[model samples]
Target: MPSSPALLRLDPTACGLPRRSLLLAPLGALAGGCTPGAPALQGGWVGTHPERGHRLRGELPRTDGPLKKAGVLIVGAGIAGLACARELARRGIDDIALLDLEDEAGGNSRAHALGGSLCPLGAHYLPLPGPEAHEVNELLHALGLAREQFGRTVWDERHLCHSPQERLFIDGPEGGYWHEGVLPPPDGAVALAQYRHFSALVAQAQRELGFAMPTQRARWTAGHAALDAQTFAAWLGAQALTDPQLRWYLDYCCRDDFGAGADTVSAWAGLHYFASRHGFHAPGDEAGEREPVLTWPEGNGWLSQRLAAPLRERIHTGRVVMRVTEGRTGVELMAWNEAAGAPERWQARAVVMATPLFIAHRLLASPPDALRAAAGHLRYAPWLTANLLLREPLLTRPGAPPAWDNVRYGATALGYVDARHQTLDPMPRPPLLTAYRALPTAARGELLSGSWQHWAQSVIGDLAATHPDLPGKVERIDLCRFGHAMSMPVPGLRGSAALAALNAARGRVVFAHADLAGYSVFEEAYTAGVAAAARLSL
Candidate 1:
């Protein structure tokens, strides 16, 4: 793991995890470079990461009293803040306080229980960590999750992802690993070849372990950053890898990773999807395939809950911090105490603002002009995920057997993950699978204002393209929209000075967000949080 700053080192009370526990959290942004003429919309003219506001069930309570005098004040209850708080608590430094605008601590990791299944409100899955990704390993181990219990990583048949891992519904039939025996004829062969070729290229990039020049803050291998200079479309064009079928696959990959199409994501970011991964088990553990990613029905919210366990009592929710100014006394956090229904202040020697960059912009109280300029250039893509409860298993399209992540080859974003996939109960009435659809910003205007019925109808309509009776089978539809889900990793966004400037802390006031990490992945959030904490510890 990269060296985190000092602020993250403060220790909390004995009731929580060790400071070391803070070091590992689940395990787990953009720049604008344009020529003088107001650059043309290079790729798809779409906002990549947008937000879907959280629906507060009731009015929040406000607080006026000082929770506690602390050496550190961490803002936001999302994974980043929780992880930081957990780490600080473990450190034996009890003088700490955490605040968030939401009444809950998970932030985007929030979930809802519906029809016997849990649905994720924000992030869903975490990629297994690489060898260098020590932070994740530490976190998992700290959480009491032993690699041995996971069965040596090859995903033993018992622990292995069950029979139907994935499937694609084409025309009228199904084709995927679940239906490996039912491979589609020659046409299927063509698509497979395309996938093979692209996979090979990504694999080659991995072998090379490419690193960006100067090597300071590349998201993945340096090699991946070099690829950032080109758009995925341009990269594909160079491969002469253009076929309508292949295009759909590429689009699916981009939609899954960037919440947009291949044409929109930077080629480097797309390659990182495959290349940055180095999945291998122990020496003797038939590690043919990488470790099977472990997830709960509500996706990453499960992990967030696990991490929050140790800090439940310390977290202050619905407290929107509006400003952070350092003084001779320490750091002053000017914030709104939701519970008390009034503006309140907090004092700490150091503070970490773990909220999103856009939110931080307001809290920082007049950031450097460059940071402000970059914040303006950065764009977030909004996403809407629908977790539908089905009355019964919908008819499989002849050859396709539904698996965990059922993705439509050329349809809306990547399809849904079967919530019951992880459940042991093999009864006929299994839990319903939730479909997560990411609507493009252009479509956001239409989707956001629409009712749940409208969104549910849209989801069923799209699935109907392949599964004719899908709409009738759905018993309930739960909707959660992440308005600013993630930042788009565009070409110029990779190395923009503006993003770098936002990360710069002008004395006492520090910035923290998964966005500042420049990549919206679990590790990025955890690492960024720790980094902010480390800086304060100094």
Candidate 2:
């Protein structure tokens, strides 16, 4: 077994800059690489390859009695499995099969439509990758969106989102948007500036090569990976970054990415959140528009539907895999076929466990030591997304520009995004905006088992605090709570030896999950899917 890059620490000074850092000031900017295009509304890239629906080897043989066989059997039809399928199919392998407990292909990125508007069940946005992401660019062009500017003002095509994106509802008044224009209190102003400074510093480090190591083991950097082996709390204290400004930034970042705040996450994992985004745009430099995200009337399910188009007939829904055993001859999967109420078996050359870590911990037989270690290290947080249908558009303080995402300062969780934002023209009725709650790990058991009415009332009450008239304007309230909506990069989890082990594939079983990547973002999912495919192909 090779030493994982997670454990490496080379000389940072040799790369230039300061002694503690690697590479001096980027050697005069290196031409700023390729410019990324504006973010599009499309999924960015979907089925662009020549072998969009190509399969590997042959379809799994249908059996009258019980068992079936294939070259590679992938579990979970999420992005990871689909990416693997696409890669393998392109390589002239057509005998692969994929299965998932859910009927769709995208795991968390799935969406559903309500009242003619599509709302997200899990993920919605995919940020622009760095300029060096050639493969992503290729995929985008192939998807027919290479030149399209998403979210651009159709009339002018020169501006984007009209500037101010997000505004905060604070102390009975709007505290302005996240950047300029919105007015914040003195402390808020100070905190926001400091936060920006810190973000800029982190971005600088990320732009450099030493800290941006992509390989499995640590690269030519001096900083110890073990330094990240502590909770964000410990790391912050050690670095003396406990000022209110720094704290607020960390708290907001944690909430946005992991659905938890700083104290709940690992410092290393938190750093990974900022360091990993390397999105790119073309025909221009950093001044170009962001890569637009593709969305369905049902949110990301639009992309899922496209990816699953070719494999729709081959999919077997409700097949809950109970366990997997790797025998001398082949791998056998023991599953409870939910549709027929019978236990079924499957044999294949390779298997992809695309399910969440929590599920994988119990389903695979004699799991590799790394997987066991990861199972023990990984922790997931539950979520509650409350969708409220309003009879009237709740009025806010005048001059407070209405945007998609609305947040409340010092709230229980981040606020909600108007699911109807994508629809430009006016509508006869007010649509639903989903209020998402990142319930603390300590509150999971109670929240999950609570009554629906109880949860709905609580959510309404919370929203009412900000929009006093919102409750009365609401016509219908629909509640959807996911017990394990996301994975938390718990403090000390990132640099742990166990994590490195779990990330490593054992024999024919390849592991892929948002949790394994440290950051739970859409791009990470895409990268994970692509990485899993490359590994399997090798």
Candidate 3:
């Protein structure tokens, strides 16, 4: 078993990131190369468009605008906000309004379309809803993704992710290449045994403690809750699970879901990744094959779009909610309309703050000490996603064909997801590959201060290792940098009193967002929204 410090310093290159460049070069020079007149990287940058959100840090110019009246005002149009609005409408509450700072309302679930291909900016897939997830099941049924057949929910076949679902490339026996799934190659018998042991442990945890979506539903006994007291790496050490391959796979799962490594993530949160889906079985499938996932070319952006469709007229894009004050009869909100170039005001009987917790702290007026302390304890992990439009398919050596998800072992980035993998029609043109990387909390400063060109170069260079001709096959590369991509479920964070305080409603304002769940995921965000709406309805 490795010491805590040893686990903490797993490996500098474990994330598959390139070494820091010695020379600091300008954006133009770095992107197009040292040679002048070379064409710049074909794509531009897109994100949540942080300008208006940043403006919340300082006071805005006072405006004499009349306050608009609303029965409910939801301050955000992300998944949580949209879910709140949708739930309100479902309950026959129509006098509600939703606002978002981004031009589009999906938040990180936003999608981009280029040359007839659609790709995701952030979240891309959702696991099959558990039996206890009633709201989620209902939402899926409403969206035509699911239906009741003989008292069992049946998911749409077309929407399910097709196989050859995932593959991994590692330096090992078969010319340093292994195919099928993200697990370690079969050559590592000891690692495989450890993985099996770990799986049994997760199953036991699920049976005993109950790890499932909407985290609020999980049975948090003193024994299970104790898991949050230690780091995942520490737990691994205690179990004597010292296989390097096993550790790497576990670390990858942490980075992929929580945007942090095992050493920084909580044992409970890490185990939740496995236990949460313990009994998740797709509709009409009893063979116990891999659980099916609902996905589209645009990823969860498809679900986001559907959630926003009914509330389109009620959603106000580019409206930044700067402040929220609880009044005797209702809640008052001051916002700045980027499109109108002026201040806007709203008064609502109830308000749901579906924004991130960090933003909620800034917007709330005279927040309670508990809320403030809870917000302070919350940490966010940054992520970078680049969509590369290729003029041709990636050149492959003899092995499995291009899978929907391609992972490179020992690389900083989590390889790339092929955006065209779900296309029904025959692709007559090149494909669009969406590459993803979750920057460790330590690298957040570097990502923020670095130029887009530098990040772009890092992405291309990383992929070049897997596909040698990747550079020349690329035509456009659009980069999406999420400074606070997902909430990091560090040790002592999940199931903590701080998180409970953060989730509690304050006066007329109800909090909603994935962060409240202590681990960011589609189900948590949606559930948070629904929970907030239920509170507002009451």
Better of 1 and 2 by lDDT: 1
CA shift of 139, model 3, Å:
0.3
TM per candidate: 0.77, 0.75, 0.90
- Which ranges in model 2 have alpha carbons more than 4 Å from their true place? 1-65, 132-136, 147-164, 172-193, 207-227, 238-246, 278-297, 426-429
Candidate with the larger TM-score of 2 and 3:
3
Candidate of highest TM-score: 3
Summarize candidate 2's per-residue lDDT along 1-538 as a digit string, tens digits.
Answer: 1111111112221112222221122211111111123221111111111121121123432333388888888887776667667667767777888877654567766775555667776665444434444444444445544454584322222212322345655442231122212222224444445445555545654665333312232342434355455677677677556555346546776877788888878766566555655321111235324333443334555555666677676566666666778777678886655567666778898777776765676677777776777777777777777666676676555444665567765555677767676555554447567777888878777765676556665666666555545644555556666666677877556556665665665567777666666546655555555666666632
Candidate closest to the true structure, highest lDDT: 3
Worst 10 residues of 2 by lDDT: 41-50
> What's the CA error at residue 26 for candidate 3, in Å?
10
lDDT of 1 by residue, 395-477 (tens): 65555466777765445656777777866776756446667666677876776566555555556555544454454455556
TM-score of 2: 0.75
What overall lDDT, based on C-alpha atoms, would model 3 receive against the true structure? 0.78
In candidate 3, position 182 carries an lDDT of 74
